[model samples]
Target: MHELTTVTDSAAAQLQQVRDLVALLDDAQYVRRPPGASSVAGHVRHCVDHYAALLAGAERGTVDYDRRERGGALETDRTLALARLDVVRSRVRALAPGVLDRPVEVSGIVDARGTVARSRSTVGRELLFVAHHAVHHLALMMPVVRTLGVSVPADLGYAPATMAFLRQRDGGTPA
Candidate 1:
């Protein structure tokens, strides 16, 4: 059997990147721009909340993350969201190696048809998914950042070889 090691360290590093990005964003960037779109910061807050749920489920052995009904709490304020982000990061980092040996229980609508689904996977896989999810959204956010004349980190995974070629073509240092 291929033993799966906990990706807690890499997750921690990604969380640090998220925190850095959050620090760099101002109120205008954090708030919603489009009438129907979620704010960029709101998406990060949602990702942190997902991490909190995953951590809780890992500890308790079960959780229903797909439940859309309010779980008896008001919407968290930005300060509270940041606090929860810190706590979730600490929890993931502190988890024992063996903790990820088992699969993670997750429930949610896997599609747009409003059908709810349940599944399980190793904690390491789940963390990898979460990291990639953040990367996916972060890329979508690049245009928004560029519109503000801010340069994003090139190492945010744009195929290093391609980036190097583009930089060389553009007469700049290869990233």
Candidate 2:
């Protein structure tokens, strides 16, 4: 098992990257859903929904990722999206240290047919999942941002494990 603090810290860093990305974009860019791509605000809202589900479920011992607030201001309004970004980050960081060890029942839509998969997990594990979920969405958003002529962090979309490997292979430098 991994140390919960380490997992949370890395997750926080990932979210911070997202915050930085949003700060760099203009109002139009933030809400622009590029052709065949999701908008930056869309990704932020989706991530917040997962984080919200995790936070809500942590208290009850069951997390339903399928419970999402799809579309609306969160996906269109930059101000709302930015506020949610901060709130989710604060909520994530404020999670009780011991809560990570608590058991949680998890559920999510798994297929095109809308099948739901169920499983047992710990809050620490769910935190990792939700954070990585955001990172993957960030991956999709990065290319869209790039095509719009905006600069972004080189390591924006990489998984924590991949980032560690990159630093190691590159002699402690981000490459």
Candidate 3:
């Protein structure tokens, strides 16, 4: 339960940071594209899409990362994105501890031939994966945010282990 809570809280915090950053951007900043780079809106949409997929999988026994709603209003409307973030955060917080260890089927591409592979996983593991996925996308968003002159927290996109290591190196106790 503790581990589940930690992961949920971490995810919630990451989403909150995203919400904060997005709140500072106008529509142009949110949707602006640099050459060969994804827009800030696109990154936010991708992260939220994964959370939606993970939550859907938690309800069913199968998880498919490839099944996603791409380029919806979530990628353009900040209010819509924040609303979805709230819903995902709430759903994550409401996950039952008993369901954390339940077996689940995870499907994804595994080979150069684009063959879909299926494997067994647990809800807890998938939650951790989603959290990490959010962090990964957030890291990618950092440069976009900076280019837009938006400042976010230093730990906004760091993993738990990375944050702890950074804290220790800075002569602070590990978070």
Candidate 4:
């Protein structure tokens, strides 16, 4: 297969995985967390928002994300969240094809001091960043989930179980 096709296939798979995981979560489990930290659903929605903007920015070649809108009530209903996840997935799917050639732009404030900074990176890169960000939050919430007495997914990981398994089967673990 061509490199672009491979890239497209991989991105599509990742996006689908995200959708699947979000679907698996219930509102109670979505919003429940440990003593301190955002709920698993909250973090997932936040990442979805970021990924949506990143994909759009990649298409437009502009950095247009406001981190101020990071964590907040994401719709108050699981149905709305699911709808929004579909929207995010649509945006990602639209950009994944063109992203191999054009890098997207991401802008954010450096500090609460009001310093703005902009950077250019591929949509693929931004997607990876968002995925990693989600993983970090998910890891933090894992313990929270346990405390809440919710059953955790058997295969949650920063590097996804499929990727991890592939790496392991290839003779070594993914670094």
Q: List model 4 lDDT by residue over 1-175, tens digit each.
A: 5465455454455555555655666777777655657676776666667666766676688756674366555635666767776776666556544555676667887889988898877766666666566566656656656666655455554456556677679855434
Candidate 2 pairs with clashing backbones: none
Q: lDDT winner among the candidates? A: 2
- Residue-level lDDT of model 1, residues 1-175, one tens digit each, is 3244436776766666666655566656655344545555666665676666667777766544554333222133445545656777788788777887767677777778978777777667777666656556655655555565556676653433455688788855535
TM per model?
Answer: 0.71, 0.91, 0.90, 0.73
lDDT of 3 by residue, 1-175 (tens): 3777777777777777777777878888889877778998999899888888888898899999889989989888878887888888788888877787888999998888989999999988888898888788877887887887876766666667788887778955433
The ten-residue window of minimal lDDT in model 3 covers 166-175
Q: What TM-score, to 2 decimals, does candidate 4 have?
A: 0.73
lDDT of 2 by residue, 1-175 (tens): 3479887876777788788888889889998878898888888888888988999999999999888789878877777777877888888888777989999999888999999999999999999998899889888888889988997767777777788897888856344
lDDT (C-alpha) at residue 128 in model 4: 61
Model 4 misplaced stretches (Cα beyond 4 Å): 2-18, 67-75, 160-175
Ranking of candidates on TM-score, top first? 2, 3, 4, 1
Worst 10 residues of 4 by lDDT: 5-14
Q: Candidate 2: where is the Cα deviation over 4 Å?
A: 172-175
The CA lDDT at 132 in model 4 is 61
